[model samples]
Target: MSQSAAVSPSIDLPENKSGPHTSRLGLITVVATFGGLLFGYDTGVINGALEPMKLDLGLNPAKEGFVVSILIFGAALGALIGGNLADRYGRKHNIMLLALVFMVGTLGCCLAPNWQMLGLFRFILGLAVGGASTTVPIYLAEVSPFEKRGSLVTRNEVMIVSGQFAAFIINAILFSVWGEHEVIWRYMLAVAVLPAIALFVGMMSMPESPRWLASKGRKQEAFEVLSQIRSPERAAAEMEEINALSTNGDSRPTSSWKDLTTPWIRRLIIIGIGVGVFQQLTGINSIMYYGTQLLQQAGFTSQGAIVANTLFGLASVVGICIGLMVMNKLDRRVMLLGGFVLTTLFHLLVGLSAYFLPESAAKPYVVLSLVIAFVFFMQGTIGPLAWLLLSEIFPLHVRSYAMGVCVFMLWITNATVAFVFPPIVSQFGIAPTFFLFAALGVLALIFIGTMVPETRGKTLEEFEDEFKAEYS
Candidate 1:
């Protein structure tokens, strides 16, 4: 193959390979995914706990929002620092480090005495969430076979939603039994610590990312790691591919800022950012973050809305599973386009129904149906696809920094939407809130259709060749 051809190479794993280590990869996935679990629990715990949390903390709309959104801001900062840390310390080491942060953040939140303390702890929790979000998927993607990469990395998302569901159920049971006990929120926050411990313990047995090892000139170590996961013949071949790409590939860029100064790199970063923003702007988090309280305002009681909120989490989990099933069978660009278009329609219908209907018997179910549809479409399409694409795009040399910057923008946009959602619904009503999300959804569809390229079935090196073709 020509050098340019080698730049964007793809491979098929051997049809009849077996090993002691196949299950080992699955084990590693479970370990790394604890980050996702903690993220889900920490973020979603507030949904059910919000009512009691508010009354206990004396929260008004603005302070409540700040308390809710503080973690996202912490996540933004965490991504920035964690990306650099992973790049410097190695993926495995930083993952272990992040688990400790997760524990501290969770414990802090659980022990918080007031809203101010809660915000402070949640910010710390965001750091862990952001770190895991960036690191875990990349770790899984790097370690997984391309044939199985999409499905494996998406487990992180599945775990995330599952954690959310567990939180809702736990909160419901606790609330029902305890009925406004002084510290019910603590139980909700404290549950997250289990996942943190799992992440830390799991990392103790996991190997470092072989690719990261190779990037730093540890070829022998890379081959050793690869051999554990691949058949001997396959492992040897894989190493050759990595060696060719990393050693003879494009010279490593000195700074991430260079991607901004350079045209192709800049465009790729922009596309990645669009994916991140679109993923959030679909209003998925709106349901996850405020599903209970928002539904209560729409006419359900506190307990009723929370029980209803579980359905969104459940739908999202199921949708992403279907998405993982279709990943290798379909192109990512198609998923993004089709998902957003349907999501746009759903949001519009929900807004119109909520707007026109009296706060009668039918309106809450209608809004609930719309939220369910949005979550389902989001998970099956944009949810898993966005995360997979972000992990795949960008050159290996600049992947960490570029991903950090893009995800930073993603977190900020998420925080902005989350912060405004409660107040917006309070001021303008549910119909208008859904209407605004629908408008942004339309813009996102246009952006994805025009700007984002298809990345399915391509190798990382081959994707780089695309950079030269598109902007060279």
Candidate 2:
């Protein structure tokens, strides 16, 4: 084929031809998605650990907010710089480095003598969390076969929630076993170190992303990486496509911020940021980060709340599993719209249950069920879709940078919500607080309907051309 012909919008290649290739791809996915697992455990551990940590450190509500939200602030910075690092160094290197940071931060939190020290360590951990959030999905997307891209990329999403569920279960076990110990929170933070070690050790044998290698003019290495994960025929065909796309000048290695100033790129960035911001505005993290507190306020005792919050974590894991099963089958835009609608309705119901339900013993259960439903819809739809779409929408050259920016904003929004939620609930009550989320959910619905594009069933290159043609 002519170079230009090979650079056409799409190319067909063989399907599922090599068992070894599929196993290698599966292994890579498992190793790389350790980042997602760490992201979940680190973030979710705080939900249950915070109460005991507060007691141990003598933290007031302000310090509690600071400790919870500081990591997110650091995450914003991490997401910003991580993309540049990945673009320059390579995805595998970036993730391995993040794993080390995770170990250091986890150890720091575990050993900290004061809340301030814990906050400092948590901020360090946030860097890894932010980097993983941006890099893992991109790595998965680039490495996955086009037909299985959605499900494979979203496997990271499943691991993420699975990590959270593990943390919740672990925290409950620890709290139940050592509830009297002031140091239980330290042990909770310590569990994360093992996975970090695994990620670092596992990634040593993993290949660099072929798309990334191709972008950097490393065609031979790119083909070698692809050959490990694709049938020989398919590998050669894709290498041709990657080479043609690289040489045609349609997608250049992003040199600096100047390259992303084009109108279409700007539009993609906006859409990415909107998707991320809306995902956070669903108040999902508020629940994830403060589920115990919310449960306590709703009427559960401290131990009871800790145990009940596991249910939320379980719902998250289950919901994302469902999302993965249908990830390739469903249209991205439709899933996003349906998720927002369902989550918004659940938000309203939760608020109403808290507002009008009398102080009977059943009120907490009612509110809990509604919140669980909200989590189910949000995780299955917005949770996976936000990261998947962010990974998919950007051009190869700017994928890291664009995803970093969007996730940076997403973390910022998450920080804002985390910092404010306690005060909002304390001042205005849970009803009003969730009602506010419901209001934002309405706005999110509008944004998705108007701005988000359908990305299902298209190769990254094809989607890029289609998006540019329509939006540029």
Candidate 3:
């Protein structure tokens, strides 16, 4: 930003805005975040449907894993393409397109006649999933006030886990009511359509990402968008700040992958990738994807396992709410460190309990409670914060590129965990599986202590200036 730009008034959101504006902001968040809901529901819905899908389709371990992971592979491709698309067309518009793909994917999954067909459709769905996971946070962060950005963007993460929980409950109910039915997996797959439509129509009425508009040099449109989310005092101030940042022809590059080979961009990409990969290695999603199996091993029946897994999702929502409360108050580094410590302890306890306990009925319940505690620690500490950092760590011109590259790693790591977790349990059993996760948890604690920076109370403009000074 220029000296004149730095002199512009800092934006301060209303401490006394009317409830209607708040509701509008909330509505925008909900619509944009539906992208995340579908992301969670589609991926998580499979956990329950897996057994039934496998039984119906006659799949073995390998094919079953394929059926589960094919979407992730498609998501990787989707992230790359979607990032470019969002950067080009506009965030809200791209999200609308993604919602359509999500709807079609759900329909395809519901109507798939065979495993091969299902894998193909899941891949299609993944494209939308991957797209939403990358675009939604960027959209939310760009639209939100710096003070509220972390919480706003993380709302998507909260919705994601909540959606997964909802899918689990809905699946469990459908399974019970329609027990002994062969096509029940079809119902499980179909549940995602309602939210997909909600996302599509909701996005249709929403504004484009404010930052994206600024990046595109549509200053007037960007200001109008800021108006909807901010008090008039703040909206005008943010418009000036955005204009200042865009002075050097927007500082938003439209470039090929080869352009990202610059040293600084490369380093930032690595940081983003670290942010993505580390979040997953913490093994939070293992609970989302395979918690039922883990609970069953600890000795719960099928019904009991589904009921127990819902607690993790509920804990995740609560944890994210707390996380949002403290997000701006705490540094990203503090949250990461504290989260690592808390999650590590939970993992250790989970492993120790299972290692010492016999196959008693109480063991499953104990493990379920531990899973709940683990999620509470995980979501409150690492889950919401990781994506927030990832969204902000890159330079302005390369933000989308850096995010897409990084989130690609995120989804891949997720796929690895989801794909290998079941086999790991079968081969080494639950004791070693949790132990391995616990050990990785320790490594994560060490990683956070040695690296990661504090980024709070800093605007994107301030962040760029600070990083430029540090690196120069």
Candidate 4:
């Protein structure tokens, strides 16, 4: 079936405005971004909850890894189909479904009777995480003006880091007050439910993606939604571009799989896949997922490790804040290149510190400092940019589908790393693991330098034309 035919035509957008107002646009962005908040909170809660969960659930190392990594496993599947779901359903509608999934999964995990049940629930939560990862950026990208797209899409990234930061603070407070209590982990897991509810309520009134609206022949609805977010003049101009692109895409088969046979489409998808792979290969999620564990390995006590891990979360939030401020000014390609290079160096230094300070009392603090720096580099450059690029890189017709495929690979790679990370650390120690990541980072750098295109300051239609001319 044609991709366009797969979507429903009667989808409704948010309440329309008579004129453009920045406050209204901000409200749309804020509401849409609740998805990112939940994504970050669910994932980050695990960083501090794992040890307590392990003890309460009688989990051994292997089961601990499974429980922690299982969410990512589900995320891989969610991401694999998330783009198609967004295309088939409206972006806003799909996110609402994801919010429901988030609440159910969080409740299940919090009340899980055993380790197996916990794993099952975590996998369910992964679906929402993966779906939000695919859907939210595309939604934001479509609603935003071309000039402001980079910064606006990145607001979701900032919210993600902010959510992680919130999780860390909550983890620290709960652990401080109730150290080792069986219920502390449950509290951490349950906190995510609040945000899930927030997402569902907020998205209920949110507008559909104007691009998605245009794609399915709801041009007036698209224009009205666009008019709310953009100046009337700018809205009219962008609506014209969207109509032209929609008309052009109408000639091609809507099935993204069939479109892949075209050289440019294939090349674009391949590049998108590369970007997703490299983003995960940087080993950032491994650190985010298990920062406390790694700090303990570096010689910190359990309490100290959790507190120090908060630093990692803070660094990410700060880094992303800086990224938001400068994203419009920098070239996307350059930001990614610099991120890879800097992260590789940080990885090497971390490995070396582990080797040289294996017996030092200050080992944990030194390693912690270095890891926070690594996160800063990652969040400032690759973390936000990866999602931004994925949202913007694909042509209008297959943008969501292509993003889903790319983020699917991303989640799979993340799951693989998370699953094997414990064994790798147990067998070889933290030092060697950092070295391994450093090696992968070198490859990521090469891929970015050679394969990634600069997408800054261009309309989606402009990119579509460029890709068609170059590869089609």
C-alpha lDDT of all candidate models, in order = 0.82, 0.90, 0.80, 0.84
Residues 1-472, candidate 3, lDDT per residue (tens digit)? Answer: 1222122124342342554557778889888998988988998898788878888999998898888889998998888888888777878888999999999999999999999999999999999999988888888877776767778888998888888888888778887787578789999989899998998888888888777777777778888887888777777777777777677353664645875786656666767777788889878888888888888877888888877777777888888888878877777787888888888788888888888987776887787788799899888879988888877766556676668888899989998998888778888877788788878878777776655655676677656655555654
Error of 2 at 105 (Å): 0.7
Against the true structure, candidate 2 reaches a TM-score of: 0.97
Of 2 and 3, the candidate ranking higher by lDDT: 2
How do the candidates rank by lDDT, highest first?
2, 4, 1, 3
Which candidate ranks first by TM-score, i.e. highest? 2
Writing each residue's lDDT as its tens digit, candidate 4 over 234-281 gives 677777767766666532315467765678878888888898888888
Best by lDDT: 2
Candidate 3 achieves a global lDDT of 0.80
For residues 354-406, what per-residue lDDT tens digits would candidate 2 score against the true structure? 99999988999998899999999899999999999999999988899888999
Encode model 1's per-residue lDDT on 13-67: one tens digit a residue. 3532767778878888888888888878887888888778888888997888788
TM-score of each: 0.95, 0.97, 0.93, 0.94
How does residue 259 of candidate 4 score in lDDT? 65
- Candidates 3 and 4 compared: the better one by lDDT is 4
Per-candidate count of clashing residue pairs (backbone under 3 Å) = 3, 0, 0, 2
Runs of candidate 2 exceeding 4 Å displacement:
1-9
Ranking by TM-score: 2, 1, 4, 3
Please list all clashing residue pairs in model 3, or write none if there are none: none
Query: Which residue pairs in model 1 clash with each other?
Result: 7-461, 8-461, 8-462
